[model samples]
Target: YIDFYNNNRIHSALGYLTPAEYYQQSILQNVA
Candidate 1:
């Protein structure tokens, strides 16, 4: 069973953003 909770699918924990998106946003924030 693939755990598509937040990591692969929309996660309510991260404001409905996937892990990749959240990570990318974090990186972008740091860069700026």
Candidate 2:
């Protein structure tokens, strides 16, 4: 499912952070 993938997919380029976590951190960084 898309939701499962978004929350669980690990990104090697992102230091293995999940897509959801990576996006969340990116947004926070951008806002800061």
Candidate 3:
């Protein structure tokens, strides 16, 4: 599923985090 890939699939280029996960974590880091 699209949601699964964007929010759950791991990508090595992203340190094994999904695209959505990486984006969310980055945003949180930026805000802190």
State which candidate, 1 or 2, has the greater TM-score. 2
- lDDT scores of the candidates, listed in order: 0.79, 0.92, 0.93
User: Lowest-lDDT window of 10 residues in candidate 3?
Assistant: 1-10
| Higher-ranked by lDDT: 1 or 3 | 3
Arranged by lDDT with the best first, the candidates are 3, 2, 1
Per residue, candidate 2 scores C-alpha lDDT tens digits across 1-32 of 99998898887988899989999999999999
- The best candidate by TM-score is 2
Q: After superposition, how far is residue 12 of candidate 1 from its true place, in Å?
A: 0.7
* Model 2 misplaced stretches (Cα beyond 4 Å): none
- Taking all chains together, the TM-score of candidate 3 against the true structure is 0.71
What are the per-residue Cα lDDT tens digits for candidate 1 across 1-32? Answer: 25465467887888889877898999999999
Q: Which residue pairs show collisions in model 3?
A: none
Counting only residues 3 or more apart in sequence or on different chains, how many pairs clash (N, Cα, C under 3 Å) in candidate 3? 0
In candidate 3, what are the lDDT values of residues 1-32, reduced to their tens digit?
Answer: 99888988899999999999899999999999
